[model samples]
Target: MILETSVVPRDSAEPCADRLVLGEHVLGVADGATKKPWDTGPDGAELAEAVAGHLAATAAGCPAREAVDGATALVRGLLGDAGVGSAVSFCVLHLGRREIWRVGEGRVLLDGLPVPPRPSGERIVAEARALVLRRHLADDVPEATLRADDPGRAAVQELLRALVGLRNRPDPRYGYGALDGQDVPDLFVEVVPVPGGVREVVITTDGYPEPAPTLAEAERLLAQRLARDPLMLDPPETKGKRPAANSFDDRAYLRVAL
Candidate 1:
C-alpha cells in the first residue's frame, strides 16, 4: 500500500514527500534543500521513487539488507543519468517472521523503544554525496575489482568527501544547493525474530520531527493513533502539518503487521 499527499504550491517541480509500503515492509524518502535560492528540481524525488519501486518489487523475496542494497543501487543509477545531486534517506522493515535490515538515518519504532539516534552530520553528507557519485562508475568497475573488498563501496565513500567540498553556488537556472549544509541522515536496522504474534512496524523520514522535539515523540504520537485507529495512518491532517512544498524537503512513513 502506498499513501501520499502533496502539500501544494505546485508551481515548482518538487513534490512534497512520498512513501511506499509493501507487504510487512515500509519505506519513506525525504529530499532536503538549502534555503539560499530555491532550486526545486526533480532529482531527489526521482531517486526516491526509484528506491520505492525497487524495494516494492524485490523485498518480498530478498534479504532486507540485499533489498536495501539493490534499491540503493537503483537510486545511484537514476541520479547519475540526470547529472543531479541531492540527499537521500530510507527505511526498510521485514515482518520479523524473517530477518530485516535498515541503514541510514530515519525513525524506526520497534515494539516501543526508539533506538538511539544514528550519527547525523558531515558523515551523512559524505554518504549521500558518494551514493550519487558511485552511479557514474558502477558499470566500469571490474567484477574482480575488489574481490575480497567491495571497492565500489569504498570508492563511493572517498568520492563523497571530495564532492562535499564543491559547495552549492548560485546558478541563474538551478538556484541554491539542494542540500544546504546539514548532512543527510541514515540508519542500519534489523528486527530480531519473536516467537509468533502480530507486530507493528513503523518507518518515517526526519521531516516528521523537524518541528517536533525528537523522533521518539513523533513515533509515540503516531503509534498511539495507530493503536486506536489504524485507518488514521494516512490522513489529510497529516499532510497539512508536513513541511510546505517547495521547501525542497520531502518525507514518508509506513506501518505494517505480520
Candidate 2:
C-alpha cells in the first residue's frame, strides 16, 4: 500500500490537533476538538495523539468498536473530574479487510465520493454564529476582528454554548457525535469493497472542503477560497465563529492506495 499524508495547524505556534498513525496492518486518523477556556486536563493535541496512538496499537488485533471504547475510557480516566470534555473525530482502517471504523466528524472517501458517517455539529454552531452576527451587523465589525476578547464575539460564543448545550440533550434534532470521552451510540463501521479494481481511500478532517478531488487540489481550492472570502462572511458555508485568519482549523488528510 502507498500512503500520502498532510497535516496543517490552524495557528502556527500551536500544535496541530489532528493525528495520523500508520501501523503494520492498521491506519488511524484522529481530529481532537478545540479546547475550551473553562475546560481542564490535557489540550486537544494531546488528546488526539493519545487516541491515535491507542487506535494504532489496538486496531491490528481488536475490533474497531473495542479499540475506540478503550481509547475513550483511557482519556476519560485521564480527565478525572473536570467538566471540560476532550472530544475527537476518529477513524481506523483495517487494511486486510478494507474495513473502516468512523466516529464523529472526519470524512472517508472511497474512490471520490464520501462514505458513511458525515459530520453534524458545525452546522448548529454556524447557524448560531450567523444569528449573532446578523443581530450585531450594524456595528460594522470585520469578521477577522471578531476575537474572543471582543464583546460581540463573546456574545456569539455564549450563544454557541447555549446551542451546543441544547443539542447535547437526550433527544435533540441534531446529535453532534464525537469521541467525547463518553460512550457513543452512533459509531459507524463498515466493509468497503473496491469497485472495478479501484483501491484508493482518502480520509480527512473536516478542515478540507468536500468537493476537492485530491488533497493537493483541496489545499489549492482552500487557498483560493480564503483569498476571496477570508471569513466566509460574503457567502457563508453553514456560519460559525469568525476566524482570526483565513484557515482557522487544524487539517489532516491521508490517502492510502492498495
**Candidate closest to the true structure, highest lDDT:** 2
lDDT of each: 0.41, 0.64
Supply candidate 1's per-residue lDDT for 205: 61
List candidate 2 stretches off by more than 4 Å: 119-121, 134-139, 147-153, 162-172, 186-197, 233-246
Give the clashing residue pairs of candidate 2, or none.
Answer: 126-239
How well is each residue in 1-258 modelled by candidate 1, as lDDT tens digits? Answer: 332222222124545434453544434333332211222344455555555566656544566545545554555455453224554445555542344344444555544445433443334434443443344336665323322233333444443444333323322222222222222222233333433542544566644442223345554664454344321112211111122222212445554444
RMSD of each: 16.9, 3.4
The per-residue C-alpha lDDT of model 1 at residue 204 equals: 60
Q: Which stretches of candidate 1 lie over 4 Å from their true place?
A: 1-14, 23-42, 81-84, 96-100, 122-198, 210-249
> For every model shown, what is its TM-score relative to the native structure?
0.48, 0.82
Query: Which candidate number has the best TM-score?
Result: 2
lDDT digits (tens) for residues 1-258 of candidate 2: 646788888767678899886677777578987766555687778888888887777645666667666876877777773224556667767776567777666777877777756445556556555556655556787555543333433545664565345322333345555555656553333334545465787888777655254778878977876677554444443333335533747788888886
